[model samples]
Target: MRRFLYAENGAVSVYLILIIVPIFLFQAVLIDFARIKAAEKESESAVQAASRSVMSSFDSDLQKRGLYGMVLSQENSEQLFSEVFAKNLSSGVTANAFHFIDTKAVDGGMRVTPVYALASHAIFEGQLLEDMKLKGPIEFSLEIADKFQKSGVKAPFQMGSQFAKNAAEVEKLIEQREDALDEAWHSTEVMYARITTFHLYYQKRISDLDAMANRIGLHTIDELRIEINQVKDQLQSLSNAIHNMDLSMSSMMTASPQSIQAALSARSNLEQQYSTLSQKLNDLEALVQLIIQYTALIVSTKLEVAVNERDILQLQQSIEPVLRLAKQKNDDIRAKLTAIGGSSTSTTSDSQGVNDVFQHVSLIGDNYFYDYQISVASIASLFTAFHLKIESIALYTAANTNQANAANDAYWTLVNDFYSKKSSIEKARMDANDGTKAKKQTERNKIQAVLDKAKQAIGGCSFIQSQSNDEALYNKLQGDTSNLESANVQGFYQKYRQVNAQDVLIGNDVAYDLDKAESTSLRAMDILGVITQASEMLRDELYVNEYALTKFNYRTYGLEKDRSGQAKLSNELVDPGSHQLANQEAEYLLYGFSSCAANISSAYAEMFSLRLAIRTVENLLDPEKELLNVGSPLLVLLVAAAQGAVEAFADMNALVKGESVELSSKLSAAILKLTYKDYLRLFLMLHSDNTKLMARMQALIELETGKDLTQAAAYIQTNATSEIRLWFIPQMMKLFNGSDLLGCKVVGTQCQFNRTAIVAY
Candidate 1:
């Protein structure tokens, strides 16, 4: 040892060898360490990105295929797995391979095998061993026979043969699995396409059905209008007949000469006939007015009913397909629900990690299934309620039709009786001549006796006895007889002569006498002609007045204006100078005018009353019209609302099925956009930061995010923690006041990572 150390030349060689060898070894170690670290980091980043990408792609694909809520799409599953593998193995060490091994096999046997591979390097070099063996159930052993230096130590590497075997086996399994998944995916795509087609077809059917219903309703309304118009024409004809009868009666009254005893007796007989004809004409006029008013009311009411019924039916039908889809989606979501709770497990421990996996799957199932079920149930319930309401309306409509028919029958019968009586009286008068005057006088006397007996019988009643003798019985009798005498003379001398005249004079002196005599007839007939003329003049007036009242029976579109006209007329008659009074005084007398108006106002009051009764009957027959307008734009809105709701439900279900929540809120926002207009006005009102409302919003926000506001305040004091937490939560809260965030809950608040309030302003 002393001799070796003392050799000067050899000592220099030993020092150089020690320094150079150690430095070279250290440099190699450093290089290898850096390479390994870089590779590890790259692999980890790639894997993380790949996993996230896989989830994103899976969710998107699932939604497109309509499989997220109910069932997994085989195509989407395969595509997602492929995406993850492609992203992970596309970089770093050559020949990197990846595969998803189904731990749960149908045969109850676990198969740990590669399902995908990417080879960029020769397989014989053992480059695929690490990734390939990672897919196995246990640690795979490899023998490396080649010399390799690592960490300053030389080791024999001989894992080439084993790696090659593993690679070959993995490649073979992957190819088989890829084929199977591709086939399954293709089949699933076909199924989904069929489902979509069916859904669209059904939706079209529903739309067509709604359109048909609307057309039916419109047709019914048209039919009702026609019927009403026919009734109005009949009433108008009757009114004209009454007016002619009144004129004939007046002429008959005037035809008798005053001096001769026989002529006086003839005059008396004519007066009786005139009185009877005038009364009959009055009755006929009343009946015609009633029919006109009632028809108008019925037409209006039926139109309203048909509109309502059609709207309800359309709405119900529109939602049927949507409801069915929702139900099916809900069932799928329920199946996914079992995975929901499992997702809550902590990922810190291996056991917790496994729990998370199970929970994730279960949560996905539960959320999708529940959403679908709830949506379906809600829509179904709404449609069911709507249907029930429509049925009830139908029943009411049938009842109203029966009532209208009965009332019409009664009215027409009265009209027929009046017409028959008038015809008989006219025929009897025409048959009478100079030779039969005495006989006719005797017949007239008998009829007068019967009339006097009727008056006596009416007078015996206590109600008649209570009236003042001078003011009631004597006045009534005198007025009635005087009117009869005038009507008889006018009818006999002027109208009868004119009708029988060989030379008909349009404006001769003879015709003037006839006209003058008619002017002196019964007060009611004279008043009727004046009322008719006045009504014609004021038919366009808006306010009810004496003029309007006289024209009340006039109809333009089956709507009653007579009552309104009479009410106005009465108001005017009581206070012609009321226009100069203050609003208060005018209003005070309004009630008095209304009461007195009924007695002296035009026949319009009765017409209006009859119209109201008919309207009531129509409403009873078709109640739906009262609910909503079928032809209005609201029907389209209802259909759109239902469609939007269904889409939202489907979106939510998809998210739940895939355990994906990132875009769930976005889907909910889309849904809100569709229906937001309905509540926009109300939303604006509630957006004010009123004391009561602000407090409620703040409390709700705190409860939802599970973050104590007090703690957030304290954390804000620290710079580091503040920076992290402030990035999203505070900005999000600020941009959206509480109400806006509330809308997010529709898609599940948990997915947002924080419960946010929705500001509606």
Candidate 2:
């Protein structure tokens, strides 16, 4: 055995068994490893090719607008994948090594387990940029984007929009003020009517008192006393009626309720003084009766008492105009009586008796006339009080009337200005397009509503009944005391109306979450690795707005003839049963108006506001208008607003007619022409909330597509994933001779090479 171990006997055979066997085994393992690598490569290629083939079946509707998205179904995607996979494997050497691979894909060990998907705003940005590049040079596209960004400045337009809202509110407030003033003026007129009756009643009382004084000589002391008593009773009744009055006001009064109460108090005090005068008049009547008896006694005794007939006449005349003359006449009559008594120098008892009677008569006459004079003065004072009260009311009413007239004038001026601006707008509309009378009437009705609101605000005034006599007015006032109170004329005129920007009503009520969280997709990039990851995409806001303008339909699109008679663009399949905005999709997207009419109006309003802002800025820049640094800022702003409104209306008309308008109305300046579509793009870019934009876009897409985007196979996916099984590698390994470690288990029976493709645009 030792000799055999060392000897050359069968040495070649043993050496070959040791070295050649190991070497050949090593070569077999190497060959199996190479085969496994080839299978892995071939399977990966097949999956990548299948994915490309599936992507090729893009949605045709999206493609028409230069957008890209796969119109995928599970069965279709699977079949497409299986066919392409089979073709890729069959064309290679791996197909011959693994006969099962050449069979149907399902029969083979290949399987698709999970399909991950991605679709977002970020995904479509790349394709849009590419398509934009093909349409124009990159520099030119960038310039357009930059031009839109710079020219469509939102600050000025936003300020103008707020100003428009403020102006509307102010206009309404002015109308309200005018209405209040009207009510106030009417109330004042009513009060004036009532007070005039009081004034006439007092004047009649004075005339009656004067006539009674003039007839004093023709009547006995008793007759004069009866006339005075009758006049006093009439005055007492008038005072009582006025004192019981319960007048009040519904609105603010120039004279406060307290002032009215004070006037009534003064009348009541005067009535009290007049009541006291009745006692004095009774005393004077008794004294006059005594004087008549004493005068008869003196005459019978032949002791004549000196009395001035002229003094009596003077007393009657004085009663009509002056109360002081009554006292002077009484003093003269007493002096004459005293002289008669002094001049009687008889020492006899009969003469002394006559003198005593004369003295008694003179004293009675003096007291009677003095008391009578006081009575007349009291009536005159009451008359004066009534006169003063009437005068005060007249003054109040006159001031209010003046203010009411002024308010009426101002309101008419405002109306005239509004009409002028409206005419300018009408001219613009006519210049743009002459619609049917019905259409024009419809537009006019909308504008008419605003004017009607203002007109209605002024409202109606209270009707006052005119009276021919004081008695009739007194009777009416006795029944109703409301007109006696003043109204809130000063408050209405003095109150300042304020304008708020946030309170502006655009009338949009579209439901959307602006603060919703969102996930961004990268690109349609096929990355083959252990950890599959998506790429990044462009996220420029201006580009997104540009995309929206190109893809969506506007309100006026129905009028265009090139769209196959369809009223709107059908970007996706819409459910026939649902009630959605079909024609005004673009307008709804921008202004969120539900009806086509509202949408159109809103669009016009928006364009009008923007143009108004631009024009206002121009007005401020214009030194010739002289609207800056003035006492009445509101007036200046109103003037600017008027001009802006006119120009804005014209601009909108031009835009609706598909005519280009200059960004600035300055003809001498550089021309920056903007079409209707360009304006829409600018409006869209004004939306800053990404989530809101996305949600609105998704809502519109779902409405058109008739699909629930949250569900499977409902939305366009940018990313897809598949697991490729290594059937060829496992089968190829079985053909090579190897130990248990060298079997297909070394690389696993099936290889899971995750290949994911993400679409970014």
- Which portions of model 2 show Cα errors greater than 4 Å? 1-12, 90-119, 124-130, 136-539, 558-583, 622-630, 698-761
Q: Which regions of candidate 1 fall more than 4 Å away from where they truly are? A: 1-269, 292-303, 325-329, 342-761
> How far off is residue 180 in model 1, in Å?
38
lDDT of 1 by residue, 1-761 (tens): 99776768677788899999888766754443343334334334443443344334322221221111112233443345334433443232233444221011011111111111111011101212332233321111111001011111110001111112222232233333333333333332333343344334433433443333433333344454555565556556655655665565566665655434554455466556556555655554554454444445335444543454354344334434443444444344344333333432322222222122222211113453344334333433433333333233332234533443333233234334433553454344334322233442443344334323323322221321122332222221112234555543221112212322323111111110111111111111122222112212221111112111111111111221233443223221223212211111111111111111221121122211112222222221222332222211112112222222233334323321222222122111221211111111111121211221212212222222222222121000000000001112333233343454322111111112121111100
CA RMSD (A), model 2: 33.8
At residue 708, candidate 2 shows an lDDT of 31
Model 2 worst lDDT run, 10 consecutive residues: 518-527
lDDT of 2 by residue, 219-291 (tens): 4667766766776676677566555543332232677778767776866776676676667566657556654
Judged by TM-score, which candidate is best?
Answer: 2
Backbone clash pairs in model 1 (N, Cα, C under 3 Å; residues 3+ apart or in different chains), count: 61
TM-score to native of every candidate shown: 0.16, 0.42
Candidate 2: residue 266 lDDT (0-100)? 64
